[model samples]
Target: MTEKMLQQYKVWDAPTRIFHWVNFTTVILLLLVGTLMYFKKDLGITGLEAKIAIKEIHVWIGYVFAINLSIRLLWGFIGNQYARWSNILPGKSFPAVLSSYIASIKSGEPQQFLGHNPLGRLAVTLMMLILITLAITGLVRAGTDIYYPPLGASFAAHIAAEGVDPASIKPYDKTGTNPEAYQELKAFKGPFGDIHIYVAYTLLAIILLHIIAVVRAEITEGGGLVSAMFSGRKTLAKKPEDLN
Candidate 1:
């Protein structure tokens, strides 16, 4: 067997690498806490205090995730060449990239990518959009249910305008003047929570598949997608023009 000679390239920049791992870690935490919050009753998590404590952690972590996602979305515009939005969105070369990937899969040959390959690029784009939806829905749900912040009080105002007296409503898990009003608030906030939970689950499934595909690429394509996110470098073939 012949050894493959590779040229080192600085593909992932420092900011991009940090954003990737922090987002990954935060998402995992969100999933765990979210599950606990969703099933705290069935999980034998008794008392309103215990549930509120769990909700507090989940809500704050969700805020951090939303902020992190915002920075990433902005960085996609101002970041390095490899991290640019244009690089990930289907550009003029995407068709060729996809065709090449398919060919490599069937022929057992490795294809090089200076940045995200076509399939990976598509996955990342979809994940980002989904993350934004989850974040927005989470905010509305938190506001309506617990009056957290940002949009929380705003949602409260809306419900208050609906003939439910403001003084009658209390944040969930707390004694309020009117239990019926709080139930109304919960019903108003229901759709946002539903969407957030559903989209979050979808994102989890996508993350698992993303991990699988990246691992497959690491073994077959020899691109350091995972390691490169940590070290900010990758190995690719030197072009013939550069060899001159």
Candidate 2:
């Protein structure tokens, strides 16, 4: 075979590549919005209007994040081995692999794999669960209020007035008229709001660690691990004996 033909290999499928980048972008955006919401008080931004505007952006972006996560999860099951949930979780042979990895570490030798190693798999799984929880909590907090307001002048008029009398009333106008409903909305949002902030911080730490691990692998392994992830090709062994 020609050198180019011998070098041809496929690693990440198209769907997996798309999912990886999409999740990366959404995670970064979510972190930014979360930070703004968490530190809004300390930032000393004046007026309820500004605060509400920030929150609206945060909540809507959260909805988009949730949708992206759901699509990724579905793709994981239907995608390639590397992207599958089963690949991340330890299987029946995990004990032997774990032992080999531990022994290699103690002997100052490197363990290699085409897919995520044990520790990397664990981190990926944990990050996915945390993200899913954050998305669900955000949806639960927002969907209820957006679809059905508990108090205020009544979304009833806003719903009817949308096309009939656009200038007649506003959504917040209804909230202003119903103090009790507004308090109920606040009660639902407060606790989950705190949970979301803490989860975001945890995810940030995990992301930093993940990047560090990738950098270390690229430096030590000489295998172009990072580029392999994007290009779906790695340096092949020179001989069958070099295979591990």
Per lDDT, the best of the predicted structures is: 1
CA lDDT, every model vs. true structure: 0.79, 0.66
Local lDDT at 148 for model 1? 83
Query: TM-score of each candidate?
Result: 0.87, 0.76
Off by over 4 Å in 2: 1-9, 144-185, 236-244
> Candidate 1, residues 103-154: lDDT per residue as tens digits?
8678876556778877888998899889989889988877776778877666
lDDT, residue 190, candidate 2 = 77
lDDT of 2 at 169: 37
Candidate 1 segments whose C-alpha is farther than 4 A from its true place: 160-169, 173-184, 237-244
**Which pairs of residues collide in candidate 2?**
151-181, 152-178, 153-174
Winning candidate number (TM-score): 1
- RMSD per model, one decimal: 3.4, 6.0
Task: State the lDDT of candidate 2 residue by residue for 37-110, as single tens digits.
Answer: 66888889767777667767777777667777888798778887777777777779777776876676568656
